[model samples]
Target: MTKETKKYNKWIVILSITIPLVVAILFGVKIDAELPVFLPPIYASINALTSIVLIASFWAIKNKKVKLHENLMKTAIIFSVVFLVLYVAYHMTSNSTKFGGEGNLRIVYFIILISHIILSIAVIPFVLITYVRAITNNIELHKKIAKFTFPLWLYVAISGVVVYLMISPYY
Candidate 1:
């Protein structure tokens, strides 16, 4: 890695660890306040939008529309950040919503939820590294990592919406 690329490695490591830890700590905090809106649906919609953007990004890159791909990928990242903020805000203000689902559906919901949660955490570093590679003009390395990052991220985005949809009725 060039010095420029190497410099970002520390930031990527810091963010990759800090983000999940901060989110986990924040999940334990509750603030007594009435939010102006119901956030679950909003965040869920953001997740859905992120998925669309990710697909668009893929299509753009496949077509050699590099600028378009860059923009779409950035949008997807922004949507994800917005979703996280809103999700954390919602959780801080409201109580947890239990899944009213039972039997096979309940099992299925948990399975999706578990996988989604795991992948969401796991994708952080992949995303950061892939992004760094791209910004540093390390196209070949970026492409290799992005193959894994793209699917992992797309799954997380899609499954977030699915989890929200499955649990929304109880909220």
Candidate 2:
């Protein structure tokens, strides 16, 4: 492996541990009152924005606008970070929302919800690896992994919004 690829090993290690620990801590922590009530809608909009940015970035890259794609990806990452912070903040201050959907839609909801949950966890390392590759000037590996990363990240982002919609009524 090239030095660029080797350099990313640290990031891979850091993210591998950081993400699951963060998830575990956040998941274990519970909140009682709903202070800072604006977090839900804000994070939901961030999720939607992340999805839009990801699609737009794909289009930019397809048109050979590398710089545009870079900017879009950076923006998408920023939005995702903001969404995560807001999500954690909201969760830290409010109770989890209960799903209210019923009947056939419940199945649909659960599928999306489950996939989103799983992908959300899976995408953490993918996102870190993909970005590390790019930043390390390992374009070949970056492109290879980006194809995998994009859809997973996009799905996670889009589903965050869907989950909010499905559960917001109970909140």
Candidate 3:
């Protein structure tokens, strides 16, 4: 590993550990009595935007627009971080809006939700690793990991929007 990669390794681990723990803690705390009631839609929209950015980044790379691809990917990462912050904040202030759909739809929603949650967690390390590789100029390894990271990240983004849409009515 390059020195640059070593420098980022601590941050990757810190973020990977902190994000889920903070989110979980915040998710259980409700201060709806004090906060405004407008964050869910906003954060959900961020998720949709993140998904779009991810697709655009993919197209950029496929067309050999390396600079555009890099910029878009960085933007997508920022969007993801924004989404997480808003999501955590919203959950901290408001109760979780449970899905009210019954039967097949409920099953489908749960499947999507479960997978999204798992992959969202998994993607953190993948993203950090891929990013570190790229920054360190380890192009081969970056490309290899990014192949897996892209789809997982995209699924997490899209499924976040899906989950929001499904549960919005209850909010």
Which model scores highest in lDDT? 1
Q: For model 3, where is the 10-residue window of minimal lDDT?
A: 28-37
How accurate locally is residue 57 in candidate 1, as Cα lDDT from 0 to 100?
Answer: 97
Question: Which ranges in model 1 have alpha carbons more than 4 Å from their true place?
Answer: none
| Cα displacement (Å) at residue 15, model 3 | 1.5
Candidate 1: residue 115 Cα off by (Å): 0.4
Best by TM-score: 1
Model 1 agreement with the true structure over 1-171: per-residue lDDT tens digits: 688877899999999999999999999999999999989989999999999999999999999999999999999999999999999999898889999999999999999999999999999999999999999999999999999999999999999999999998887
| Cα distance off (Å), candidate 2, residue 36 | 3.4
User: Model 2: per-residue lDDT, tens digit, 25-47?
Assistant: 99668777667467888889999
Local accuracy of candidate 3 as per-residue lDDT tens digits, 30-95: 775655559988988999999999999999999999899999989999999999888887777667
| lDDT rank order | 1, 3, 2
Comparing 1 with 2 on lDDT, the higher-scoring candidate is 1
lDDT of 1: 0.95
Of 2 and 3, the candidate ranking higher by TM-score:
3
**Residue 38, candidate 1: C-alpha displacement in angstroms:** 0.1
